[model samples]
Target: MTDTLLTPGAHLFQAVEAALAGGCRWVQYRDKSGDHERRAREAQQLLDLCEQAGARLIINDDLALALRVEAHGVHLGQGDGDPAEARRLLGPTAILGVTCHDSLPLARQAVVNGASYVAFGRFFPSRTKPEASPAPLSLLREARAALPNTPLVAIGGITLDNAHTLIAAGADTLAVSHSLFGADAIEARARTFTTLFNQHSST
Candidate 1:
């Protein structure tokens, strides 16, 4: 996730570039500044960077921007828009992710609505969204069982220390923000995060 505050100004792209170089395969452009021009420019740049690195870029809550930049996909929060409509517009190949919070029912609905993946969390305290409702680790387990075929994303307050627990509990992806871009060594942090998944898969 890209945050203007976390990585202000040009540092955003630099941080993302470092992450990509460190084996990060997916990036979600998550600036909520409402600056259409800047967002579009940054999203396009991020998309280009991701493409060059053989990674995927997902625009957050901005279907129009995603389409404008021809991004890999768009992630929709509950109030963002209709996932089915997004799916139709993005076509079958685009990756559509829906933030289902802690509800399995919402996740199920998202899948039915053509979401490529469903996200659940705030498993731990979140700096990005402090007031966001907390989701239990068991939610990941339950979602895994219920949405067996869909990719499950664990979001909110994810860090290297606690990331393993989420993956162990059945989270296919970890959506991190502060802990990653806020690190002094963004590349190393990203590499370590990627290593966690690799180590888990090998086991």
Candidate 2:
């Protein structure tokens, strides 16, 4: 996930490109700046970068922007919009992710509403959404058992030290922000994260 504050202006694309170069296959453009024109331009640029890297770009909470850029998908929060409606517009192939916090029922509902993946989070103190409610590791375990086929995303406060716990608990994806783009060596940090996944898969 990309943050406006962390990678503002030209640094945004640079950071994203570095992450992609480091084997980060999924990129989420998550700028809440409310500048429609700028957002559209940035998102389109990100889509192009992802395409070149054989990666997928997901626009955060912007169905229109995702559609305009022909992005691979859109990640919607609880109040963003209807998942079913977004799914209908984005079509079956486009990935539709919904934030379910720590609620299994919400995750189930999101799936019924056409969500391709479900996110849960704040497993640790977050630099980017500090006030967001913390989700328990048990939630990921339960959600995985409940929604075996659904991709589970764990967000907030994910770091190299603790990310493996989330994966062990059943998180298929880690929606990181600060720990990634905030690093001095963004590509190296991203490569480390990618290595963690490779290590996990090998075990």
Candidate 3:
């Protein structure tokens, strides 16, 4: 997932473009600045970008903004909103992903409540979310056992150096933010991830 985080400041659009340019098929618009007008405009812009790139757009934490921008999905954190109601609002086909942290039970409940995917996080130290909840590589394996059919996203501090471990442990998507966009070579960083993912799939 591509996130417009705190440090990347002015280059948010460029960050999304960098990801799309690197053949990223999914982009999550995660800006938490609480500026409704700007966020809506930016979200619309990203929706257009994703449409042109054939990339899926997942809005983070904002159900209205997601629907307003007609995003492909919304990723919900614990305090974001209720997954069931989000599913109802987002419709059957709209993707709904939930952050499960390190809890298998939360992941199970999310799936039961119609979450299309579950995200576990902070596998490595995170600059974006330094105080974020920590999750183990073992959690991914356990989550896979519990929700075999559900797509699992491993978030927080995921980088090319350590992402293979997450994939090996059963993470379907590595939710990268600062590690990809915080760098000057955004496209290159993204490619590293895609390359890693591709190589893993082939093996």
Error of 1 at 62 (Å): 0.7
What lDDT score is found at residue 117 in candidate 2? 98
Instruction: Predict model 2's lDDT versus the native.
Output: 0.94
Against the reference, the lDDT scores of all candidates come to: 0.94, 0.94, 0.87
Q: Candidate 3 lDDT, tens digit per residue, 79-162?
A: 999999999999999999999888999999999999999999889998777888899999999999988999999988887789
Candidate 1 RMSD to the real structure:
0.7
lDDT string, candidate 2, 81-123, tens digits: 9999999999999999999986899999999999999999889
Worst 10 residues of 2 by lDDT: 125-134
1 or 3, greater by TM-score: 1
Residue-level lDDT of model 1, residues 1-203, one tens digit each, is 98888888899889999999888999999988878998888889899999999999999999999999999999999999999999999999999999998899999999999999999988999988787789999998998888899999999999889999999999999999999999999999999999999999999
Task: Give the clashing pairs for model 1.
Answer: none
Shift in Å, residue 92, candidate 1: 0.7
